[model samples]
Target: MTSNMKTQVDDQMVLLSQYYPGIYDQLIPEQGEVVKPRRRRKKNKADGNSSMMRKRKLSDEQVNLLEQNFGNEHKLESERKDRLASELGLDPRQVAVWFQNRRARWKSKKLEEEYSKLKSQHDSTVLEKCQLESEILKLKEQLSEAEKQINSLVERSDGISSTSPCSSFSMEAMEPHFLGGFGMEGLENVFCLPENNYIHGSLDWMNI
Candidate 1:
């Protein structure tokens, strides 16, 4: 310690001795209060303890705000911490720790949002896949029904042609005679007619 520092320490000791008498005298060991040189301890590699001392007293509001900003915005947290530290005349490390906590909080919130969105997408995709599968099943059923109908029609047509002699004749020859048996509805239903008294095939009624 320098003369100026010794003077200051001595002045502090005198003021402090009034509150706790003999405390300063015992610790300081005064013979006119000679300034003692501080001893440096050798570092033990096995010991994890740090020589660095903690600094700065922080308020809840300041700590909370720094932490909160870190979570919401890293850039903003850094800028705010720097600005706040400057304003409060605190070390940058104090502000940095506050922002670190804030960032962790923000990361948790962001992860939650992402998880929710992924879950929503997964649910929607499942629904769409189920719907498409149902539609495919419905289309397959329709195709099966249509095939049965077509097979039935083919059998009926074959029977008609093989059993009916009228299959060889043109319809123009039988038009006048057929016109008498056909009512207004029958005429509407017929497209091609054969020259015979017996009408001998399954009619396709779907168009009518």
Candidate 2:
């Protein structure tokens, strides 16, 4: 490089050093040793191979034996786990994990059964309540019809009395067919009350 260009470069570096003192030492150290950024170590072959390892499928005979042992004891003792692992030619951890998985499946199944039973009972109770409500609504509709009949009877009786001063009410005309359960004697007594007393008195029968 030319002398003038080198002088200009040195002057620019000096100005940068004034503004950032630490950056100048990294770019141009006093002893002239170059600084290299530390590199991260790559993963070992063992770690890479461990991730690629495939799961081994258990033999039919091994599965059957495990099922038999699980049925007898849902939770195995440590010694029993080691004994089964030895017999099956497998690790103790594998035997223990199998039992854990089996227990989890069993617990889930039991919870589902319990939930199904409770849901069935709740549905039945709701249906029974709906049926009872429907019955009550029907009875109310029947009672309304009966009230209209009673009002008609009272009007007919009142008209007859006004027309003939000496005439007595007909026994068959005054008898309410819908209220046959109530004795004719009790019904006749209420109607026998003179004047407008009978109209208000008839309301007593509906109190039941």
TM-score per candidate: 0.44, 0.47
Candidate 1 lDDT at 68 equals 62
Measured by lDDT, the strongest candidate is 2
Q: How close to the true structure is residue 204 of candidate 1, measured as C-alpha lDDT? A: 38
Report the C-alpha lDDT of model 2 over 1-208, residue by residue, as the tens digit: 9999999898766654454445544675448676543333434555646644344667888889999999998999999999999999989999999999889999999999999999999999999999977876665555556557666766786776767642444545653554344333234322333354433332565343
Q: Which residue segments of model 1 deviate by more than 4 Å?
A: 1-58, 67-73, 76-80, 88-90, 162-208
Which candidate tops TM-score? Answer: 2
Model 1 lDDT per residue over 134-201, tens place: 87566445545654665676667767786665344342443444333423222321233334434232
TM-score of 2: 0.47
Rate residue 55 of model 1 by lDDT: 32
Model 1 lDDT, residue 195, Cα: 46
Pairs with steric clashes in candidate 2:
none
